[model samples]
Target: MTNLTCFKAYDIRGKLGTELNEEIAYKIGRAYGQIYCPQKVVIGCDIRLTSEDLKQATIRGLNDAGVNVLDLGMTGTEEVYFGAFHLDVQGGIEVTASHNPMDYNGMKLVRENARPIGADSGLKDIQALAESGHFQEMSQKGTTEQYNILPEFVDHLMTYIDPAKLRPLKLVMNAGNGAAGHVIDALEDKFKQLSIPIEFIKIHHEPNGHFPNGIPNPILIENRGYTSDAVLAHQADMGIAWDGDFDRCFLFDEKGQFIEGYYIVGLLAQAFLLKQKGEKIVHDPRLVWNTLDILKEYDGIAVQSQSGHSFIKDMMREHNAVYGGEMSAHHYFRDFAYCDSGMIPWLLATVVLSETKQSLSSLVEDMIKKFPCSGEINFKVKDTQKTIQKIFDHFADQKPMLDQTDGVSLDFGAWRLNVRASNTEPLLRLNIESRADQNPKPMQDYVDELTQLIQS
Candidate 1:
């Protein structure tokens, strides 16, 4: 049997030609159909040049395996997630590599109601079947049909906030020439029909496979200047940018400063809690103080989960959480079948802005000051476990409280840090934070100490 390296812990991702190609895509589709044997499945693709051909091959495999296909042409990841749960299909697949390089492509799969299918949940089975080239013959073949899910998807997004509460505000949006442009256009049309007074200044808003601007990842420091610059030049209220598949969005305040996703978690938690008291909110372990403080004041329950989307989604389903936010900018909502959405976060942030009559920075400035964080720092390491043990030994004398949920989190009362190996890369990720009132040392001091320790 041929080993397939494209199957990852969470989803399928690999470099094209060698790791993944049309033939392999077909095998994946056939394997999924053989294992699940679902009568109907929903599928969509991003604007990548190779995506359409791969999608067609996948469709052929699904049809050959007797599973009908509903194709949503050119959609972001969440759109496929929406179709999986909202439509009468039993599963969905999104042909997207997100922020990966042009030579790479991937797929995100979900079962009924948009529940993720990670390695622990049926991904391994599909991989085995595909690797072995197993087949089951059927007399009847399934059919393929084209469908438009944008209108329904946009309508569902509107349910997250009240249009009446929105004020006249200007927004700067940079789509990075990916799949997000079409969704933005549909939302803009809806706003005009409803007479909302929000103005959108769009840039790089067309879907071009070449990615003329970049790969659409706003998380990179180099890719953020365009969005921030446009926000400042237009005097906009807020600026938003998204990655290729548009699953996670990064935000910039009115002053053109990039707000860390950690603070946005607290902001979103407060927004939901204000509307309904006693709601549950899930957050990752990487950063916690700001979220906990806000939840305590709002009389909301806070639950902590590991750092991945599948783990966070499972925890949200278990706790019936109203909202879940990761410091990595992935936000999940109970209303959206516990799936993460790039579009939802910014929409809710706008509502918060209008309701409080405050700027984006003002709403989050206190949280940033109260709990200063070093964001996330990454380093390529030779041995992750050995490095973690070294750090633990160094801090053993202080007897800091430790939490090993997703990584090693050491709480030293006044300041805390979490260091973990990256899930998708061979790198160690670190995040440190300090309570401004409780610690006399600056946040940068702790950052430098950790950097030196990790490097040495």
Candidate 2:
């Protein structure tokens, strides 16, 4: 059997005509149906040009396998996750190539309760079956039906905050020409119906598959300027921008300054801890200083897990954690079936700002000062293993505390570094942070030292 390059460790993704196509999507659906043999499954697609056709092809295969399908047309990835557990369906799939270039398309799969199907879990098996073009014919075909999950989804989101308590604040909301526009419109309608004192100043509000304003990713410095400029131009209280599928969102403070996601983790952890003081919080090992300190002050337990959505979700389930966050802007909630949401985070942030009566910058400025970080820096190495080992051996003499959680995390007295290969991308990521060293010397020295060892 030929290997499909699109099948990554976590999900399926690749260029449109080359690495993936309608045929691959159909076979994947059939393979999944045969393996799970579920009575019903949920399906959704993003605003990508190819997603709807792929969604239909996948449904055809699932129907061929005698599995019923509930199609929620043109939605965010979180909506598919919501449909999986929120409805009486056995599994869910979303056809979306989040943040990828124009010519790419992919899918995210989940089993019941919105549990992910990563490589170690069941993705390999599905790949094997899909690669081998063999299938069993069924006597009867399953049926397909259209379902609208927006109302239920909005109802679920409102549970996070009381609208009446929200103060009047103008928000610069940028959908980035992705699937987020519909959700924004829905929320706006609800706000007007409920008379919640919130105003949304929308930019790039329409869903355009061509992405005329460039790809819908806010993480890139070049792409972030639009949101920052909009916030400043509109004089809005804050700004929010999302990627293509709207599963992950980046935040901007009132001053149009981008907030590092590491501190946002701490901020969100506080939001959850305020409601339930002793509940658990699961965080990635890459950046933990801020999360740990905040949790300690709030009497909340912080559990460290390897970075990645699958690892974080599993850890949250095992610990019964109220929330789990990665420094890369992915925030998972226990209420949302242990799945991440781009929309929920900003809503909760608004609530926090209203309650504390502070600017968004004021809330996280102190955390930024206390634990200065290098943010995440990526390096492409010819040999990732050898590079990591070189850094580890060079630091052996220092005898820093080491944790092999996601990658290798070495803790010196004044600073700490976590180096690991990315699960999705082809690069090694390094994260460094120091305690109360507002200056760059401590962080810079270790970064330079590590870079030398890694690239030497």
Candidate 3:
């Protein structure tokens, strides 16, 4: 039996040939079928060149293990999540590497009701079973059939905002040549059919696995230029871009300014709170000041969860939270099976823009100015845990408040810093944010101090 290294905290993602491939995918399918023993399963794939082959191999394994499959060809991760809960299928899997490099591909799995199956939640068991390369006897061969879920997915997305309420606005959409193009086209048609005028300036609109316009990640400073430039050139209402799988989206204002995911969390929190007050909002520990302030002003409850999909989804369900967000562009909704949707966030933003009659920048300007953040800085350290302890020790003198919801978060009076090790890599991720009324110097000063501390 070959060792499988693709499994991670939340999903299966790794290099194409060495860590993840067709044989491993087949083993995973067999293992999942044996473990869950579901009558039927939904399967989807992204535009990666290897994802289709992997999807087929997994389907074969599932069929051999007496599990039927519904193939939703080339979709985002959220689509699989939607199909799992919405369709009659008892399980779902999406073959995608998300924002990973061109040389990689992977899968995200969910059980009934689209509940995530993370490392602690049956992923390790699946890995063990796959590594063993053994399975139980099958009763009979299952079957496979094609299924188109685009219309249903788009219909569900429309529930967040009334079509009649959506105003005519010129916008720029950058799909990054991933799975988002299809959904964009579908939504465009829906908008036009409803007479809700929305002019979308499409860039890298076609689905191509090669990623000709570099990787479709707007988080990186370098990859943000295209969206910002197009937004300014077209004088659109806002600019939106997504990762390879289109699970997470990044936004920019009309002035060609990239809005941090942190502010979007607060913006969406307000959007939800306005619709239904006193509802709970879940957020990660990485950035809290802005989101908590918004929730407080709206008289909404705020819940803190760890910074991963599995953690956020579980917390959202537990708290019955209407919305959940992380600083890293993932936005979740209770109506969407507690799964994050790249489509929902933008739609919500557009509705807010139209209703408030505010520019995208103006909508989030005060929040950004009040709670300036360092975004998220990653340090490739030799000892992540030891480095975190060292930094915590250095800052302990002032007697800062501490929270270990996700990572070691130390809160001084004016500014706060979260030092957490990356779940997938050997790097320590640092995020610093200051209170709105305070000077920005404290945030930057702490960043420099922490940078030197990590280096030392």
Off by over 4 Å in 3: 440-442
Model 2, residue 226: C-alpha shift (Å): 0.7
lDDT of 2 by residue, 1-456 (tens): 767878876788888888889988999999999889989999999999999999999999899999999999999999999999999999999999898778889999999989999888899999999888688999999999999999999989989889878999999999999999999999999999999999999999999998988899887778889999999998988999999999898999989988878999999999888888999999999988889999999889999988877788889999999999999899999999999999999999999999999999999999988998888888989877788888889889989999998889998857888999977656899999998754447667877877787777
> Model 1 over residues 1-456: C-alpha lDDT tens digits?
989999987888888999899999999999999999999999999999999998889888899999999999999999999999999999999999988889999899888899998888899999999999988987999999999999999999999879999999999989999999999999999999999999999999999999999899887788999999999999999999999999999999999999999999999999899889999999999999999999999989999998988889999999999999999999999999999999999999999999999999999999999999998888888999899988999999999999999789999999999999876656799999889999999998988888899899
> After superposition on all CA atoms, how large is the RMSD of candidate 1?
1.4
Q: Which whole-number lDDT from 0 to 100 does residue 229 have in model 3? A: 95
Better-scoring candidate (lDDT), 1 or 3:
1
Please report the TM-score between candidate 3 and the true structure.
0.97
lDDT of 1 at 361: 92
- In angstroms, how far off is 395's CA in candidate 2? 2.5
Query: Per-prediction TM-score, please?
Result: 0.97, 0.96, 0.97
What overall lDDT, based on C-alpha atoms, would model 2 receive against the true structure?
0.90
